[model samples]
Target chain A: MEKIKEVVINNSEDVILARQAAREMARETGFGLADQTRITTAVSELSRNIYLYAGTGRVIIRALSKNLKKGMEIVAEDRGPGIPDVEMALQNGYSTNRSLGQGLPGTKRLMDEFEIKSEVGVGTTVTIRKWL
Target chain B: MDKVPILKMGDTLILAIQVELHDKMAIRLQEDILKEIHDTGARGLVIDVSALEVVDSFMGRVLSDTASMAGIMGVETALVGIRPEIAITLQEMGLELKGVHFALNLEKGMELLQNIGEIFYGED
Candidate 1:
């Protein structure tokens, strides 16, 4: 895996920047238009989550290759209050902030691989990948 | 500060969103459109998103909310020019943007709003 760029998710503008960065990286990785949209949407959701829940965070975009399959990876890390229940958080319609409640699950569905780690009072990190 | 321009045309209002909409900008648009509807007494709203390359969940929600708010104010809202890729991505994300009218282009959107006006105002 090779790092592409890092975007800070401190405000709404950062969320858009993160999405743009992800879309550009995905395009460079040879993703189709639809796939690029999917990746960008996923990044937007995660970055918004970081801004809403964590108050501040960073999104790391990376290019990955394994077995000749190229993909784009995104990692969202935040030091805000971590989710207490990862399972519930991953479930659809489980947002504590009264949003559409589709951020985590929807993002998971958009990407090829999804992983999340969180500890209450510590922080949360969400990683996702989409292959070309 | 970037803002979406809302233009008034007769009894209709047209909003062309040409910039990347951040969260604040989206919220501001909703507020501004509603205010315009009230000030102009416009019964129709046409929102052109043709230039927007990406429509994420946040933006989708804002659009939906804006439509609902317009509906509450007796304004018929028609969203136009959603690219094919955005439609597919929105569908896959499970955001159908229900309750909002759609059109292929600005002309069609205006025609739809005219029809809506006839339906509500019994035609001129």
Candidate 2:
């Protein structure tokens, strides 16, 4: 069965719900254990980033496959001040926020595939993929 | 998230961690804890994680790696109070933490350490 989950995060508290959305979808889709964990970790990192940088956002999880090898796509979007330098943001240990810089780069490293798009004054959207 | 602190009892060092152990804080925390173990020259290192709700692959790997690093520094490390939910997530994530000892709570962890050390200072 195809499943799609969407959750809007307006505060740090919303991050948990966003993560649950991804976790529940992964579990329901019959993905492998590692794939499920990877999805949950990715969601947690991105959701935390949204709260820290944009102060709000939405996490979208969509199951893309149904056969022996299943896959899912996660997209996190926010309407806030976007990153001026995407390259710098991808670098590990480089963070605009005061906390340790591990959110975006770590999230990218955890998933099987990752992509990001951001425009200054527009917003930022991060997409991650994992296959079972 | 509350910051974890280091406790010293005689020659033993106990570090209580009560927050989400993720990438951003892992390096700094590792350096600090290792340095404390080295400087104090403690026989046992106890990590309390009852307050932690989740343990991801990143954090789990770091903990296991730190355990090996502690051995080289002559300190035995023990993990205390890992919640069942955290265990389920770690298993679901296919994360393996090798060589780090664990206990259900801080008190039991201390008892195990005392037995290993052959000190047996009961009733704390």
Candidate 3:
């Protein structure tokens, strides 16, 4: 795996930046137009969650390869008030902010693989990948 | 402050979003469009997102909200130029954007708006 870009999500503008970076990286990683849109949308949801909950965070995009298979990876990390109930947060329509509660689960559906780790008062990290 | 320009074309307001819309920009656009509708008494609005390659849930909500707001003000809103990929992703994410009208392109969107205006206010 090779890290291609790192975007600091401190505000709304950073979220757009992160989306653009992820889109570009996904393009370079040989994803089709639909896949590129999927990757970018996932990045937007995760980055917005960071700005909303953590106030600040970072998104890391990477290119991964194993044998002949290639994939793109996105890692979002935040050091804010972490989620107390990870399972509940992943469920549909479980928003804490009156939203549609589609951020985490939607991102999970867009990517091929999803993993989340969180601790109350510690932080949270979500990693996702899509293989080509 | 990034602002998406809203142009008035007769009884219609045209907003062409050519850049990636952030949360603040989306909210600002919503406010600006609503104010324009109030100030000009526009009967129709056309939002062209043809240049936007991706749209997330927040942007989707903004579009939906803007459409509903315009509807409440007696204005018909048409969303135009959503790429196929964006449509697929929005569907997969469960952001159906219900109660909103869509057009294949800007010309069709303008035509749809004109038809909606006629249906709402009767033909002049």
Candidate 4:
């Protein structure tokens, strides 16, 4: 695995940057247009989560290769009020504040592999992967 | 600092989104659309997204909400030029994009808008 880029999410503008970075990396990692779009859109949702819930966080995109398959990975970490229940938070139609509950599960569906870890007061980290 | 341009063509408003719209800008565009409708008495709206490469959940919600809000204000909205890939993504995300009409292109969008607007503005 090699690190591609890291975008610090401070506001809405950073969200756009993160998406663009993800798209570029996805294309370079050998994803087609639709998969590139999926990767970029997933990054968009997760980056916005950082801005909306955590206020500040970072998204690191990485390139991965295992055996003969090439893939891309995204890691989003935030030091905000974390989720008390990961299962419920990942469930569709579960949300807080202004969200319509599409952030977590929606991103999960867009990516091939999804993992999330959150502690009530500690923070939250979400990792997603897509292979080509 | 970026604003989405909304063009008024008689009884309808046509706006094509060509820039990378951040979250704040999306919200701003929604408000601007409504304000334009209020000021011009436009009964129909056509939003072209042919230039947008991606439509995430946030942008999906923004579009849905914009259509809902415009529906309440008696302005029928027709969203046009949604790329096939974007439609696939939105469906995968479970965004139904309710309360708005979908058209293939700007011409189709305008026709759909006028068709719906007949109920709202035909008396005039």
Candidate 2, which segments miss by more than 4 Å at Cα?
A: A66-68, B1-53, B56-78, B81-124
Clashes per prediction?
Answer: 0, 0, 0, 0
**Sliding window of 10 residues with minimal summed lDDT for model 2 chain B:** B87-96
Residue-level lDDT tens digits of model 1 in B27-105? 8889999999999999899999999988877788889888998998888889999999899888776775866899999
Model 4, position B82, has a per-residue lDDT of: 96
List the candidate 1 regions with Cα displacement exceeding 4 Å.
A1-3
> Model 3, range B1-124, lDDT digits (tens) per residue?
3788889888999989988877888888899999999999998899999999888888888899889998999888889999999989998988868557899998899999898778878999
Chain B structural similarity (TM-score) per candidate: 0.97, 0.86, 0.95, 0.93
Docking class of 4: medium
TM-score preference between candidates 2 and 4, better one:
4
lDDT of 2 by residue, B5-65 (tens): 8899876678777655545466678788888987888878888877765565446766887
The worst-scoring run of ten residues by lDDT in candidate 2 chain A lies at A97-106
If ranked by DockQ, best first, what sequence of candidates would result?
4, 3, 1, 2
Candidate 1, residue A19: CA error in Å? 1.2
* Better structure of 1 and 2 per lDDT: 1
Candidate 3 falls in which docking quality class? medium
Clashing pairs in 1: none
Q: What is the C-alpha RMSD of each candidate to the true structure, in Å?
A: 1.4, 7.6, 1.5, 1.5
* Candidate 1, residue A78: how far the Cα is off, in Å: 0.8
What interface RMSD does every candidate have? 1.3, 6.8, 1.2, 1.0
Model 1: CAPRI class? medium
